[model samples]
Target: MPISGFPEWLPPQRMIEQFVLDKIRSTFELYGFAPLETRAVEPVETLLSKGETSKEIYLLRRLQEESATSDDQLGLHFDLTVPFARFVVENNGKLQFPFRRYQIQKVWRGERPQEGRYREFLQADIDVVNRDTLPFHFDTEMPLVIGDVFRSLPIPQAIIQVNNRKVCEGFYRGLGLPDTAQVLRTVDKLDKIGPDKVAAALVETAGATDAQAAACLKLAEISASDGSFVDRVRALGVTDPLLDEGLSELLQVVETAAEHAPGLVVAELKIARGLDYYTGTVYETQLRGYERFGSVCSGGRYETLASVGNTRFPGVGISIGVSRLLGILFGQNALTVSRSVPTCVVVAVPSEDKRSGCDRIATALRRRGIPTEVAPTAAKFGKQIQFADRRGIPYVWFPGSPDTVKDIRSGEQVEASAADWTPPAADLQPVVSAG
Candidate 1:
């Protein structure tokens, strides 16, 4: 039996995964983001400092090694952001300012297996960081880059719900809430538990009064496709300088997205990303009808998290939950590959004497970039054709007078030459298509 949360895909499914990842990487590179990768294990204290996700971090150890060594203190990184922050700090002198990089890697979590949550999942993340200050324009560019990626992939349409942490922090402060972070965490549960339960938790857990909880619920309910969210928050009758700053920034985000990637972004007031690291714009992405599976991609802005020697590195980033997206897509049969094997044609060996000829044919086809396989045995023509059919190899080559090839699917045979024959472009590689 397979382990519950650790997914292992079949050959065809792995091909689909590669196709999606390639699209994401190309899109990131098109936007001038350099590729990067960090180590899987990080210091225990480094992982714990992220504030959230501490409980879900997986500690690393050797099965045969005895406990009590310093090595036991290291843990597998739960997300890409923490290790990246440490990377920036350690390589501060080498990296150029306004660094932009894209990372695609696997992350481990000790959380329970659920629809979208997993113990081992792959994340494709892109981030932009700069010394002291990161321009807000990068915030706008992030979604645009992701929009292109999602559009390029063969999956359901993704809706990117955006919110500003400043909006939540400022509004909480305006409501006289002492612990804005705690309240934001509680409010982040609004989706799992309804508004009423969230309000009750705010009062009982976060020390909010009934009136404050009600006001918080109202604010969470405010969402808009344009700048209307700004006016709606103002109508809430709460006034604070931080609130003004947040509203203005959020409005710019919505307006800029509308001008460029229309209908892709919306101002969602309740996207309190639960992580304490985000201090400005936060993002969560969901497939249109798969909201129940949770956000497949999420990230945000961390203004003061990457700082060393009084120089602060403010940055914004987003991570695509590659495993979660593929899990749901494969589960629902939303997509499929053309074949399980990559062989475009299988060379038939009439007898042991002609095996070398079959090998030469395969090698020639392979040299021309065609995926070809020689028959494992010098079997009968019918048996060799059956072998190719079983593996979904579309064509079978016979080295005979004029070198004939047969399309197994249609039973069509035609004279062909291995040195010059080329299959249709669609048949050159396995095709992945949405169901």
Candidate 2:
């Protein structure tokens, strides 16, 4: 029986995943981001620092150990950002200022099993961190990179919905609501619980007046694909320096994206990320036609998530939920690959005594960068060809007088050299594409 949330892909589907990951990795590197990886486990207290994700963390424990000790207090990280923060704090002196890096790793969460939700999944993240003062331009740059990534993929179009914490917090503070975090959290649930429940939560939990709740909802409803959102926000009659600062910052992000990656991003005021650490710009990505699956990617800017002494490492980043995105696509039969296995050529074994000769041919092909395997048994020629056919192997090389290779599908055999014969580039590897 397979575990519900821990997904395992078949060979074809795994090929699709590798295909997507390659595009993401190549695109990240093309933009000069170095690759990085961190340990899977972090101190329990460290994971708990994010506050909202404590319940979703999976703690690590040894079954053989009788009791726990202080050193054993650890848990699997639920997200990459928290671990990245600790990594920065520990390695601050060794790294350069304004470091850029990309990480693709499996992250564990204890959320209930559902479509597009998982207990274990892969996440790809790119981030730029600065020691003291990170540039605001990096915020805009995050979405542009993400836009390039999605555009390169075979999946449906991805629209990155962006918002800023300062916008939400400043607006709430302007309404005489000091507990901005509470109000932001409630508004973050607007998409899940709807506007009515969110309004009630704002008044009941955030201790906002009914009128203040209405204003908060109004602000949440404001969205635009361009700078027009700025004027709409101004019309709300909320005046505060922080609100003005946030509005200007968000406008820059929106306008920059419009100029570069047109139609790839939108200013969505309701996108208050649930994580409390996001102090500035926040992001959420929705796949067109898959809206019910929720945001397949999300992250934000955090000014104080990592620090050592007086040094603060501020960063802006986004993470793609690789598993969730693929899950949704796979459920819809939206992706496929040319073949299940990587093997491109199979050398037929004429007889048990001739297996050694076939092995040599296989070796020669492999040395030339062609994926090849010798027949498993000294079976009949028909049976040998059948074996290759069953595995989706395209070519069958026969080691004999004037060695010939057959394109099994076309039923065409041609004389060829094991040392130099090459299949078409498309047949060299499994070709992944939209179904």
Candidate 3:
């Protein structure tokens, strides 16, 4: 019916959505973060290295004749992190350590589309990596930056749930479950497949007995504040070294983050990312009352996920589902821009004979960084004003008037200077309608 997985929008919607993404990228860049993008496809083998993540990849194929060799070497990227690791390795020598970069691009997943989960969607990601070790503080602060973007948009309160991979691994190993990675992938699907299916899969593939599966479920079910969750993980009688270390690290991060943005990060012990790649922290985000919309932001820490020669890169980061978030905002009427583009003032063209005069006035305003557009048609003055009104451009400029501009919104034409004309702050730029 509607291109099932790929979604597009009309002018106003696309405009508002782009406004959100622009702010995200801009905020990241403001922090001196560079931007980078990788090819959409990576070697199939690399994509499959993470079990359930591989399941989501939309594979690529040869278009030529059957004579083509079976390279079995390509697939669409499901996320930005893996390809980024490869990118750093491929250009290690030329790159700077503690590389800070942001990427805004499309990712593909061959999954059913319902609400926020689209088969193909755009993501805005930011990460900071180092040659060998990335500071743990990034785990706490990076989410705050992400939260800032959401706050700037002034949407509903968003909560960030964080957990540790080592904690999950240790807990699973304590339960006598072999292949903790496999178990993780299954548990990660708990919200989607429900406990019964996840338990069945775990028992079937993980040598987990019914009771063991229940125990794993109990672990998955155990999520709380830093102190409480750590206590629950300890009570499981799973004596593992990684368990204690992960617990301590998670506590430090949660405490550190709380110091900056109180009550923002939760120690959600169930956030087992299931990918062998994530070595430390993991994150999930949701709107306060719209948790069912799925995670609007997600990512984590990876240790040694990228290696080249004798060097490896370890880092932490997160991504916002820009398109998904905007779509949700639109559906709920939570955000919207009045027009697709900002037009500070539109110069009315009385007649084609007066076209050059209109161009001069529009140019004068535009040169000063004011977004100005000239009336395209030679029509009645009322018609010209309507054009600006329909586009939601606030003020209309008249070339021959002695510095007079009309507030299309208020219908008050005033004597204002083309050089110093200022619209009220709120009316200067169109706001995103909340719906």
Candidate 4:
């Protein structure tokens, strides 16, 4: 069989993915975020408003041959954000102020897939949508919260660079750039294509003058830092009211987040993300050493992104690309699965009558939260112990023996009551750790 970048691991890899998800989910819930899920598809019109993302969408038709003529259709979701917006708008009345939700699910993109990029992949997203106004502080807090989650895991140190679309747009317009949107598209690729190509595109494509192009290049250059970066942008003399307004709002978010999570937020100006829907704050997270993974997680705040009966639904969020993060970590040997699959303490039965004793001990251990399995058949003590070692099960319970347990690795046997015996937490099962 053949496989693409949609990399799959054995039991070990699957266990690592679960570990990453648990850490992300715990962090979101710690901040009072609830959980939510949306259907895989929405009406085409609902999706079209998402701008460039729609181009990456995978369409589902009644029949592949009749797709052109059929109005009956659906498209696999490319991201969780858009469908979540629709959900908030449809159910806005029932939601309370600052409704926080975390969604972990699969989103599909039919675009050409590559390493760390898949036709189908899982995304774990945490979002905050307001019944009315979503305070800008969350724009700063979102990344810190996400960074905190990533930091909690055994994964490497990851950084989240944040920007506001309003600031980028307003700054471009103030500089006499005609097509700010097109200018942004070029700037967004600065990391991939580099500064020179971006500068040429700004001048040739967006009609930016030599001075404007230089100033634009400066605007696009921001590094990983705290809110101090905001002062650098403010020092520029040539600016307009729109630019000033965007800067002010952007400043508030950084200050607000720093007050809570000290040294967490940065007022990066270069994050001209390609998404047109992001009205205010935008963000991208890169693993410290693995910047080539592109962004392990990225998202932003979109104002009035979803409209239910003309009522604008505003929200802010960030998503953890579970599959990509796992793939990279797996490749680097940063992930470790300590326990074998399923079987923990295999209760050995030396005789046919002893099998019943083994079964009783297994049940007793399982009730105490130790995942225990009985030996497949009656066997010699040494053979039974060998089976446990092969499965990475640390302890073997020989029920007929006066001493019921042996640490297979250490070869230490001890006598204990079945109901009272407990394996060290780490030995209970194979633990998948970035540590």
| TM-score of each model, in listed order | 0.97, 0.96, 0.91, 0.93
lDDT of 3 at 345: 85
Candidate 4 positional error at 206, Å: 1.4
Spell out the clash pairs found in candidate 4.
339-430
Worst 10 residues of 2 by lDDT: 65-74
Tens digits of per-residue lDDT for model 2, 215-254: 9999999989999999999999999889999999999999
lDDT of 4 by residue, 375-424 (tens): 88787778888787876788887765474688888888888888788777
Model 1 lDDT at residue 341? 91
* lDDT of each residue in 182-289, candidate 1, tens digit only: 999999999999998999999998889999999999999998999999889989999888998889888888899999989999999999897779999999999988
RMSD of each: 1.5, 1.5, 2.4, 2.2
* Model 2 TM-score, 2 decimals: 0.96
Question: Per-residue alpha-carbon lDDT of model 3 for 19-39, expressed as tens digits?
Answer: 788789888987767999899
Which runs in model 4 stand beyond 4 Å of their true positions? Answer: 53-55, 62-70, 256-263, 401-403
Best by lDDT: 2
lDDT scores of the candidates, listed in order: 0.90, 0.91, 0.81, 0.78
